[model samples]
Target: MFASITGADKELLSCITRLPSFFWEGNWAEEIHLTICPIPSLQDGNDLTVTRDNTGCRIEYRLPVHLFRGLGLLKEHAEEKNFFINQKMYIPEIGIMTDVSRNSVPSPEFLQSLLDRMALMGLNCLILYMEDVYEIEGEPRFGYMRGGYTREQLRSIDDYAAGYGIRIVASIQVLGHMEKVLRFPEYAGLRDSSSCLLAGSEETEQFICKMLSSIGSCLRSRQIIVGMDETHGLGEGRYRVLNGRRPPIEIYLEHLNRVHALAGRYGLNIAFYSDMLFKYGSEKHTYLDPHMQLDEKTKELIPSDAQLIYWDYYSREASLLNDMLACHRSIGPTVYAGPLLSVSSFCVQYEATWKTAGPALMAVKRQKIPMVYGCLWHDDGAECSDWLGLPGMQYYAEHAYTEGVVDPGSLDSRFLACTGLDAGWFRDAALLDEIPCINPENRWPPNPCKYILWQDPLEGLYDADIRGLSLDLHYRRTAQLLRRDLEEAGENGAFLRVPLALAEVLEIKSALSGALSWHYREHDMTALQQDAAALSELYVRVKKLRRLHREQWMSSCSPFGWSRLDLRYGGLLARLETASDRLQDYLEGRLSELPELAVPRYTLDRCGDLLGNGIWKVYDKSVSLSDG
Candidate 1:
């Protein structure tokens, strides 16, 4: 089919010649459409139908109801296309698909804010993972939703996103992660608590059908994301009460089939994670049965009509994505490739943020799957984060939409200049001849979390500058310690209302002042230092501030009329704020008086000049390396 098209038509055909040679024949290139036709029947006489009516265009296929039963073959079909295109020229449409899950319940305001940011970045789709986020109190016992938002609120978000030309796909965690439902007693029978198809009970099957039917009613999108990601721990803990004899996958497949069947009934296209089907799959870690390989038995069970969404977040290797794409292609023509952008719970350095997945994003773009989604893995639900990342997110979206390179220097400076002092300190690190900061403030970035940390020392150095960088290390260390203590104190009341917390706070402050004093002493040689007394005075004030906090420490808010947790947290934050202010004053004073040191544009030198000067050669490597 591909061979029939010559010149311009062949140009489109040439982009995918590297695909699997399994389907190649004398007339291979003549077939323009690489659509897969299984050896078996198409079921119910369904046809690959097409039409180009005046009101735009449409291609419709009357697929078999049992199309979802052959997930293995479907996967193979998807992979072959990828191999065919590896050696060719292709337009990469790297898309990110994610729905705001209820785990981090986002309101319309938040959703609109998120969508606005996404649109600015040139994203193509946003999936509303609304199932778990909103659960009614009782009745529908099998599944549960957690947030307090109304249906109107969610639809508003959907409409707003749609208006921006971003497709809003709906996602529902069908088979597992139903702990919310199991937590309540009424829905007990619906659970495969002991394994074997709810073991000893036939009612579970019918109940699941009813549950899916209900879920299907609310989701109007033509596409639905079936979150079959993590189901191993299913029926293991207290669930041993039901699914004991039935292995996790056995029950999962049953639940999957039912969902797919229901999807057909509701006139929706289905998609699910491919992790659970095969043993050596892209996300094999989430699978429980090592033997649940994509053998014939499992393959025959999956419906061909169902599309698999393969998610790969680990960027250390590309083999996983290659394997997943190959596997999905072997089965069918449609597949969804998604890469995670950021997970807020982890304190990964800003440099290694979502932009870290650039390689994977590039790979997905080249593949041009039917659907693409980016993930904001915000487990903690941080409503607002550092805006320095805004530019990076937008840049990645832009590149995904239009493949091109953007100047990092311009974006970096713009982001840093707009950010506050809290962001400026790290922004300066990029200029210090250590870590090369590409987007200091994260403005106009291709990927919001684009950054790299190298192991080798950066070149270009001077003796006087190296000495000052040494003192910066001491200041940075003290600041980090102070920040950690303050954070710990804020999280747990028991930690903050103790004498030890107060002691540690004061101790760190004193150490900071002593180090600042020594740094100022160096100015005598070159007249580079400002008044060191300001730093010492600031530290003294911080020490006194900690003393006041300790004196007023209390377990509950009885005196303040707020909750104990809130009251204690407020007090801890207040103390930390005061300390942070004083430290900032000292650093600002030093930076204003000191000439900005030239550093690597994209590396991190935590040890400052201390290591460059060979001082860290005798000190602990862990401490110094971490600083660097």
Candidate 2:
């Protein structure tokens, strides 16, 4: 009963201390709970009431103000306060939730492993974007089956996360983003073609509402993010098929209203992206005025109680963040600001975006905004896992929420060393090995160390079948060269160049392997053998180059080493275990008497055995929640 505490909002809980308390509480083993979102303000909190029934914490909170309570603040005093709070001290609770859109949902053991790793890195939440993964009517999961999370399975995640003090935020796509559903046969008739929405009739509204109410009621979290971003298809004649005519926003507003109304019924505070209001330009979308000047129309459309998440990750400009703080202050004190935490750009360029974001976060903090969330907008979750996985994300998460600042390279090295991955990269290309290979596009220039370096490989072999070789070669080669150049780079030192170069190499390798696999079947042993042989030869050369030019490589890529292979390997291992069961079917003569002769039964069996045994050896190497 976290919401029962009155005046809890004013408590001014330090980000530092709260993390310790969170971990201590989680360790009790009796009750497991994790904070997913920002702690906002601790003051003015409703008194929370929880019984010792051995279940997790139950929470409820009242909306402090009505829709227009802060309307006055929007006009007169919008620009005075900053948008970010305690920028220096804010260590954000980051997460890596598997977006099961294109693939099947991970098993409970897989999730447990994931949660365990998240906890180690101080990640406090796991938000499963359900719509893209699960099957549902009207909201067909594109490129995959449209299924749903079982109640028991959902509860397992909830309970597991609670033990590590991590909250699971249920992300459901609603309103205009329902393209997947609209395109499905069963839901096609319900869509408003002219308006490109599902709100032309009562049936559609009921259908949408049922999802929110059902998921909200069952998720067990106080917050639910109703995804309403990228509604570009709205009002493009999709709605004209149903209604005579209607603007996209009108349909959106109607759906939003319905969803908002239902969210209140189940005691959940709803969060939505603030893109639609700003999509029509600063003038057309007055709610977007960097100065917080809201036009009449904007005021009319925006709900007074709805929590707006202003997502700005790329732009270093603070005007937008500043304007939000000002306008929200004039309106009332309910506005919340969260900057998207982007690690790819920073990792490749070695140019800290936070340097630009830091001041903005400070602005939000100064404005008395309750909390800030760091968004990891991974387009393809599996691919992006390597780009900004747990270690990399955790580094940024720590810096985002805390006052301490760390170099990306240092953090990478630290994580590698701490996780015992730094040493493991040489033996095997671990996820840590991918850290140096990140080829983040460098938007900043003039300073090479400020960015990663990508050069034409002097020599190398390419392989598509063997997974880690490309990344391994990329790091080994890039580290060799960058280490040499750092000596003359001066002031920027190794800091600027090493990370960028490493990132670029990683990107290149990942793309190359993905390309080869996509085009050729991995089971083609002849092709795989050719690629592997070439890669092996290249790997040897790169190793030789490093040894020969050890000083140069070390100097340039000063912070290098290790593999956190165990991180993602856990999931892979889980798959192998399942595969082994299938193999047992063959061994026990339970099904297929013969293994696919075309497929190497020996190789497949060996691969499966290796992975199954590997997972067992590193079973304890998972993380669940951030200290905060």
Candidate 3:
């Protein structure tokens, strides 16, 4: 539809021209005039005032994001000639941390799209969580064969983020979670323990210096999130051999000081995940432990400048979150990092995300925390897209804009205000993992889709846990719903197709083990042959899912880490064909029995600790226990 837009500068006009593709639906019968007055503000994020007058629609906004929000409001309320919208974003600093360190490094465009959406939502910042996912000069192996961004690439992304008044924060590993880079023979000396660098080592210090230099030069942001969160065996490895078992607290605090010195040299404010401090203090070494306490000495030693982020994505209770927030505050200036619940799964954990985010955000508001971020981590090889986390981010905004209880009605309307589509669209897409779950919320963050899809049809690692669940029907219906949504969703909602494809694959994949084991145990030859025939179709579906996954990955990411998922898809494809052939052989009487199914199945969940580190291991090993 033709519309005359005024009061928009070149950049505003550019974003407005792109708006139709992003959020526009049915064309207007007549031309619509939109006048945007985007003003600069000293505020952390933008606030907007949208009004409809007899002449046309006008938006008075402090930043590009607020203009976008104003545009969305104006467009949504096109019918209302007389209206006024004075929207307030409560949290001083609202941002999203995307885990690009995983297999996918999202394209600048992908990030820009997110920036556009965040702009509409009045969200202010973007954190690039790169554990060696950005190139460091003099260190080629750092993020080697991973989708690491070049300096120019990062600058482009940061520039686009700036247009929307979004401040981008750099999240790089200063001490731990450098296994990807550390695994290279060149960096072996820097390694102390699993995924951690040698504490107090001059060599490690020099390497970290390079990291600080790289981010400082590459991105415009002065804020850096130094990752030293889960250095579980910090002093137990090479550090012990060198330092002779100094107290972990002393070692950790010293490392923080060293990192602080490096960060200051680069003119950057530093932050680290506070889980380690709490873990070290708690007897059980658990994060979010209410009893977790840091001694005064340790607290005093912690750098006054270091912004400690209390990261939690698991807790569901307000009391627990409040207690934990209070505990962290006692230590130092704290930032709360909650989640979209995308960690360690093929799909978004909607139920768990909502349950945790709702209480966690409420607690942050209650505590009047200034800075909060919704972290979208790509665990288990970046199986899901970062695009899927939009709903959860909007949920954070909901909590931010509300002074009293977040209105239930405003949930959909406010979410729709950010993006034209209903919030239910993203929530529905996340149901790919919610089927096999027994509880109302998928609390343990069960990724039945990942484990079940990759688990052997006969071996069935989690078969005991899902023995009686009708996952086939659940996935089938879920697939149907997604397919419907995919058809209806225009270009703006094209991401729905990925989850739809995933659900379609899961419909058949989730049921294969149940069918295989049951048929083999019952000695049903005819049923086994039918299963063999189905594998042929499943194989085709698997190939399509992989292709779709690859296309989605490539469109938004650098091509480096794709080979990792490529190998996985290759393995999955090969196994599907092998599974069919093996079933055919068994049905033709070439094999005596299915030995894989014969192995006694054990329940994983009943073990009580299955949700611990095992959760990470299970997602990795469910495909195969060992490399062939």
Candidate 4:
């Protein structure tokens, strides 16, 4: 297929030509020509129109993304073989922030694919949230052995993003969320808490300078997000010994201003998560405090140009989101961040994600906020492929691009045209967590598949909570559905394979414990034999899933930190074998009954409805319960 691009520079033309072949497959024209002519009447860089005839398709767009959007329309209406489109974009910065810090930094090739997809959806920004996964000069301990990207690598990615009119913003930690950096002996002097840096320390000041200099030297975008959210025990550790029992607000503001000053040295615009501010301001010490008050001194201390970002991933009401938006705007220049709910366990929580993002996006638009991005935060392991967020990204784009309300039909057509997959298939993957659906909107995002797949079958922690849920049927059906979709998944089969493999494991495992407990108490030899056979089948299935997961990890992420998941899968496989042996002994009457069966099962004792978000982890993800 011959392709000709006009109104785009040689660089951009090269970038577009290199896009995956499927991007242009729908064009039936023998000589496909795309011309991005400027339309003075159109909104600057936000409005575009495409017209097609026998000669070629002329797309008049002010911005590169708008041009791609025009091309997107071409493919969307390809079956018509002739069409015209005029679209005016709503939000200027429809972007995504992918967590590179949480043990899953995307490979450059995958990053390029990410850029290609974002551009197709007319997105104009990508924020890489690198807590310690980015190269910093003279800071060997910063991202050492963490698969951090080199300076050249960042520059290359930024250049690629620029071709599609997308900016690459650097999201790194300057205050808290630095456990990876501060854990080393070399950087211990800067530590105040386990994850936070010492406030008002001379050494910490110098470290901020190095961070700014190193990061600013690489990323093309002037915007930088220095995470200052959740600086728990802010003044309690070494900071208290030095600064003496000062308020968290004092320590946080002082350190943030210092970071703001250092950022200015590199001409970098700074933004930080604003939760700590609200947490400190209100008597309740929570972000949702409607009565949240910042003292005059606190308000005066805020940097005029700095942006305070409000991030929410678990709200369904637009009114609640609007109130939070109001609270954030009262403090300072505000940016909004919502979630794709692709964190923790092994799947995207679409019910939580879809419900929350809709209201959040509506609230942002209602306030006429120009910039908003969806956060794909891999808080625990990032094992759930962030690639699954494609549907969420498309949902975000359609909401931002369409004025007022989004047309569902348009969303489906555009997403299919942009990604070459039905949006429904990815939404179906959410069934991995949606089974045994309890609370409304899956607000807690019960990720039972994660715990079920790893928990020892003999000593199932959640066995009582799952007794009546019929989860085995749910998982079996989910696996059956995804297996069919995997055949049509094409090159993107890896993404579908991950959830499909998980569902296959969960189908057997969800019910295995009930069967084991039943047979052991009854001492039925016939059922004991069946249990042994089931465990044997489970061991093979688990091994296959582990191998598939490893491939999924290697294909998209950095090589480092994979051992964490590998070791976890290894332990599960080992436990499965042990369970099989114990069952064999019980069948032979060597052991009277499995000891675990004699012990009465109990519901999640203290945690109740929210027991680790349905994921079993030794280190609880709470400030009080947190070990890691």
Candidate 5:
């Protein structure tokens, strides 16, 4: 049966047999007839058919050459079911955005791994959200020391992804989120605000042109996401100082027109975040709310060729999705709905992500939107691993292609078959946020792992808020459970070391903090000595955890961003050692007092703006304990 297969069909079968699940089952040895045909524009051109007989099965895959991998997965799934079925995607473009702008840049090999995984899941597009993570000519300080991708590296990645039938699109910041670019002296004079570029400035336009030209030279895809989202102070910085105060809407539209034309010069189709248009139009300044109203003039200003992406990761309401889609339709014909993969926070919020994106995708289906993409944004220091977002990506892909055909109960099996990981483990790993002692309401944006690990040792700013639970015992039990789970994971347990190490560190810190609190209350020197000894031991463990973290980070990402974790854990270790030395000296009557440890119990609400800002501020050298 397999003798007649040749060309692309043989290639597809080879790809299928390479899957971990396929290899484990030894199914690749079975006799099968697979024929591949390329059709002209078969509605996104990714479809599969499987027919069975007494001897073996014959699979007919009709798709473009680039999408052969998607056809392979379909054939594998069909072969498992032992029945013939037709599969076609409703959403033509199933895209993913990997944000490299938020500090963590994935290495080229790891990016190839991601592309291979995306191909297995039948995804067609990959967006690298490179705000300033790519080299630009004539801009020496642009992406300086940030480990941005070089032109050759990007070209290699683009070619590698194309082999898997995935289009590598560039997501660049053309307007706002340019703080990294603005920090340099060369670009400082072109700041519209601290974070946004100076709109309507010739210098800014030239900068954007150079950036887009460099991106076009590297990436293969014609689609570009010109990011203009969350430009809160647009036209309020130097633009206001130069050209008298102008309406922000006018400034934004002028900039949009300019950038859109610039992108067109590169033969690229432009897409932008739809937040600012709705933000400046309505008094409420929201995108998902049904009450969001866009003025006719503002809507009319939108370019006919521009694609508006309505991204909402916080809303679980289907009605709001419909409303947002409706508003977007009024702006342009090409509107893409975006859902969040919930990896922006320290730990992936699986439940929240599913709840919000599931309904959002359902609404997009109801509205018959042509395209939808899931965004995995790494906001504020990409603490969460990219692999953690895989389940969410699979969820969207399944919904896009086989929502009604596939049973909800078998979703896990399909997911397991597609990606060689248990769905249960993914969900359980997200339970790091659901630890009982944490306040559910306070964990908005949900990054309990980072928050707990970074909480100041002496101040106990976040840990002190625990109401009625023993931090030491709770974290100890959690660590034990995670250790058992890691053991059961076998080969896949390497990534599990990150959360496991974090839990162990949290347990040790909790115990140390509790001991310190007791010593402070009772003025016990014996207890201080014991705690100091434990601190020394825990510091060693912290070093071990750092090693584990380094291994994990390098496995999937570049070494550039691991320094952030280094700074965090390194600071923790130094503080622990210092405190231990001071405690020992005090017990030996060498020191008078430990002023930093002489703090009273206090709970702080709204510690700082971002998630770890408060605790990080407490540890900053400039800020004294008394000031905090």
Candidate 6:
């Protein structure tokens, strides 16, 4: 179409032409006159309108460079569907947070690519949740050995994000979750406990000021997320030793007031989680509980300007959400609800995420909240890859824009068009956990594939739970199915390699489990030889899987955190070799018996839940190895 565009509207045209599907119809020879004008009262000045005429089309986009890009995506969507969207996003802020604190510090280049994808999805903001993953002046050992981003690197990322109409908000801990910073001798005095900063301490306030000063220098966004979430024993630690036996709420308010003052000095708006406020006041002590009450005294302590973020990823009840929203509104005018992508689990729970976030979004829309965002957290080691959370991100974006019910078919199409991957296949890969036949209740917190794969082979503690299932056959079939999907995936298959390799590793490991069980049960000579041979062959597959995993890790993330994967796979390989050698020696009659293999069968409470709050703990009691 022949289009005349001016101002920031020209940037929108540039972005449209860059779309991979833009050239599908050859050159645009159609006579189409397009003009994108700015609207004054657009939602947060982000409203968009597209009207078409016989001569051409006119798009009235909002001001600010970022809104231009957002409206650009809407125009592209409307053009593709052959229908104009006279819609304004109800929620003005749509953003995402990357949990760099949990591990996996994404490189600046990778983050830029992510921002490109976010623009296509119509996301307007990005938050880097860096507890200590960014360099602060005078803090040499702060992010030491963890590959934190330099000041220049963060500034470049901010500038790039601004081009796409995305604001890069800085999220840092002011009161708690300072484990990395507290480890150094210099910061040890700032500790309230291991992961929290001492409340009502001058040294702690000075440290927070330094953090704010350093972060304000690098980032361009005016909004700062001062993390005051999950300070379990806030005033019970070093604060008690210094400022004897005070109620946590008083101490918390004192610390928050100091931090809020510091943030104000830098001319920044502050936002923090509302968990601690309700947690200290309520009997239930939970975020989503509707019955939890916040006393007026504690409410009075909250800073009038500070925005309270109510984050919930597990609640499905709309009534409970409405109640939580009401509770937050009582506290402040600037309140945001944070739904989740469910990436904290070792695998993405697509259904759970949709079920929870859908109702949560609808509730927020009903209340007409000013801002809402989805979080992709890597809590506790960030074992799952970020790519796995795309489906959930897409789900949040589609729902955030439209007030009406979304069409499932159109959503899938848009996901494929924007991401170049099948939404069905992406969500289905999470089903790999089903092969282990774990109790449905226990499937969460930890993806069984990850837990089982990393379990010590010599111990095999979780093995008894899967005794009845044909694990070898199931895992092998699952691996083959994933391989077929990968082959059909074409260029997009590169992202599939990590999961595919994990499935392949599970197949060999499952087979090995069966072999080991047989040797333990029946001490026949022929069976021992067969088991030894199988272990030798499977050891090769383990090595191959390790190499594949390392390749994918290095390609997708920085080198700073690959050691976790290296140690995991490296330990698995060493154990595999040890098992193979022991079996071979016994087969050759060098030993009288494989005493470790000869274990008496005992029943395990398989029906009970195995995952304890998503963290894996090794069994306390040791398994004895007889030297027969």
- Clashing residue pairs in all predictions, respectively, total 94, 114, 1, 0, 0, 1
Tell me the TM-score of each prediction against the true structure.
0.51, 0.52, 0.92, 0.94, 0.88, 0.88
Candidate 4 segments whose C-alpha is farther than 4 A from its true place? 1-4, 26-33, 40-46, 53-55, 407-410, 605-628
Show where candidate 6 strays beyond 4 Å: 1-35, 41-46, 51-54, 63-82, 334-346, 405-410, 434-446, 471-474, 524-534, 593-605, 608-628
Error of 3 at 528 (Å): 2.1
Worst 10 residues of 3 by lDDT: 606-615
State the lDDT of candidate 4 residue by residue for 1-628, as single tens digits.
Answer: 4367678777766766776677767455346676768665675444888887767788888788877767777778766646777777677788999999988889887898888888888888899999888887777778889898998999999988888889999998988899998889999899998899988889999988888898899988899999898888899999899878988888888888889999998999999998889988889978877578888788999998899898887777877889888877887878999988877778787777777787788788887777899999887677888788888888888887877766444577788778877777786798998765455523456666666776667777666666656778989999988988888777756688888988888888877865677667776778878878889998899899989989988988888988888877787788788888887887777877678766666665114443333333431321112133
Candidate 4, pairs of clashing residues: none
Candidate 3 has a TM-score of: 0.92
lDDT of each: 0.40, 0.43, 0.77, 0.79, 0.70, 0.69
Report each candidate's C-alpha RMSD, comma-separated, in the order given: 17.7, 17.4, 3.2, 2.9, 4.1, 4.1
In the range 471-584, model 3's lDDT, one tens digit per residue, is 789889988888777777766667787788778887777677666777787888788777787788888888888888888888888887888888888877887777777778
Q: Candidate 5, TM-score vs. the true structure?
A: 0.88
Q: RMSD, model 1, all Cα superposed? A: 17.7
lDDT of 6 at 585: 76
Off by over 4 Å in 3: 1-20, 24-46, 62-64, 407-410, 413-417, 440-442, 490-493, 606-617, 626-628
Candidate 2 lDDT over 1-628, as tens digits, reads 1222222234222221232222333233222231222333433442111222233322221221110111111111223232212122243333444443322244555565555545444456677766644333444343234334655667777876675556888777766555555676766666755224556567766676667666765567878878777777665564665565676667677777777877777787777766775564445554456643546775666667776666555445567667766655554333343333332222222233344455556666565555454454423112122223344444544554444445444454434322323311221222222233232332221111111111111100122222343444555555554454444444423232423343334444333333334323334435544444443443343333223333322332111110122222333334324433543454355754323222221111013212111111111221211232
Give the winner by lDDT. Answer: 4
Q: Is candidate 4 or candidate 5 better by TM-score?
A: 4
List of clashing residue pairs for candidate 6: 66-165
Give the lDDT of residue 93 in candidate 1.
29
Q: How far is candidate 2 from the true structure (C-alpha RMSD, Å)?
A: 17.4
lDDT of 4: 0.79
User: Which residue ranges in model 2 land beyond 4 Å of their true spot?
Assistant: 1-107, 120-123, 135-148, 193-196, 284-292, 324-360, 386-388, 396-628
Which is the winner by lDDT between candidate 2 and candidate 6?
6
* Superior by TM-score: candidate 1 or candidate 3: 3
Give the winner by TM-score: 4
